[model samples]
Target: MNIVDLLPAILAVIVGLVVLVWSADKFVDGAVGVAKFCGMSTLLIGMVIVGFGTSAPEMVVSALSAVQGNPQLALGNAYGSNIANIALILGVTALISPILVQRSVLKKDLPLLIGVTVLSILLLLDGDVSRLDGVVFLAVFFGVMGFNIWKEKKSANKATEPAEAGELAEVSESAEKPMSLGKSIFWLVLGMGLLVASSRALVWGAVDIAHSLGVSDLLIGLTIVAIGTSLPELASSIAAARKGEDDLAVGNIIGSNLFNTLMVVGIAASISPMNQIDGEVLYRDMPLMGILTLSLLVLGFRRKGDGRINRVAGIVLLLVYVAYLTILGLKTTGVL
Candidate 1:
């Protein structure tokens, strides 16, 4: 492609990346600010809203791709995002500082993540994810989310500490400020609009970049697009790790993966049925995802007192991700 023809694609990538990061930050800040204002517990906000916010990029990209009638691309974005969230995002975050797993996450969220993964695979058994499958997935998503909220309410009631109640009351009072709900809604809408536009731009730019570079769309989707969309997860996890909120880092990654499977892929397939798994997805991508999930499970099981993912495990995860990318590159070039 000539330089002039390449201009829009190049600019699209740059602009999309910038917009994705900015929009994610705005979305998170606004959501957390509002939640704190409402006197929500940190555990509740972290489990639901923050987790959902971090995965927003993947959801938007997948939904847009599905709406654009590219089910394969949408499916790739979902599965690829899961892989990146686990291997690259968690790996990088743990490298910053080993993440600790919270008991609630281990007992509740992690199993739910595994169940969603297995359910996703089962739904694809017919070689297509029909609209009905999407409904089923979403039903499960809502059910899980509702259950978590209920659990949080129960936990809060049982929390008898005066200091804890005071802290929550203070947070709620801050949330009770006079800021217009309309303004908050506007920010939310604006951020979502930017995310949708940028996702489309990134997908289009990625397709062009792949063709120009003689790379397969699958490879592009797995590497560049996947990592770009996963930027929010990487950043959030690392920040949480630096603050020694290891549970948040681990929970964020786990929650993102769960959302990608249940919400992102579910919505995408609901809009347009995704066809059978592509050769790359079956041979390389799905296996890679399964491997990473298995690794996380093993790590969790081997946890010492604090259930931390150690530096050695972090290095191993990062190496596995790099090796997977290398394999994808080789397959794209017909060398595998």
Candidate 2:
């Protein structure tokens, strides 16, 4: 390829990275600020709103790809993103600091994550993700959210113990500072718009770059597009780690994965049924994602009290990711 022909792809990557990073910061600040403005508690905001915001990139990419009739790309993006979020994003974040897993997250959100993941896979067993499947997933998503809200309320009402009362007091204090509802809505919408626009540019650029390099769409979606869309999670988790906000890092990753599986693929399939899982994804990608999730769970269990994801775990995750990419390349080249 001519040097000049590479400019658009190169520029696309640079612009995509810039927008993704900017959007992540803006989305985090705006969502958290809006949550505080509402009567929502901090943990609720972190678990739901911030989690959803961190996943904006995957949702946009998958929905757009599905709309554009590249359903395989959509599925690959969602699956690859989940793997990247846990193995790449969380792994790197933990390497920065020993992320402390909150009891609530461990007992509540983690199970939900695992359940949703398995549920999604089961839904796809028919070889396609239909609109009906999307509806089921969305229903489950809302049910989980509702259960969380109920739990929060119940916890607040039954704060008889000193520790429980103290927790309730903190929740009440945080909810006291309400901002104008209209202003909060405005920021939420604006941040979402930026996220959508940037994701489109990123995906288009990524696709163009892949085509220019004579790479198959599947390979591009699995690697470049996947990593690009995961940029938000990486940036946010890293910042959270550096700030010693371990919950934020862990929460962001888990939240992103949940949203990617439920919202991203759910919405995409709702638009139009996604194609069957490609042979490569079925044989390689899905297994890799499962392995990564299981590995993270093991690490979390092993270091339960220590609250540390050491460099060794980080290295292992990185090595796994590298091996995954190598296998993908081999398959693409017909060498495997």
The numbered model that scores best in lDDT is 1
TM-score of each: 0.75, 0.76
lDDT of 2 by residue, 206-314 (tens): 7887798798887886677667676666776665566555666777777777777788888888888866667666667776776676666666664344335677788
Model 1 lDDT, full chain set:
0.72
Kindly report which residue stretches of model 1 are placed more than 4 angstroms away from their true locations once superposed: 1-43, 161-222, 302-304
Which residue runs of candidate 2 sit more than 4 Å off their true CA positions? 1-43, 67-70, 156-222, 274-276, 302-306
Full-model lDDT for every candidate:
0.72, 0.71
Pairs of residues clashing in candidate 2: none
Ten contiguous residues with the weakest lDDT in model 2: 300-309
Q: What clash count goes with each model?
A: 1, 0
TM-score of 2: 0.76
| Model 2 / residue 20 / CA error / Å | 5.0
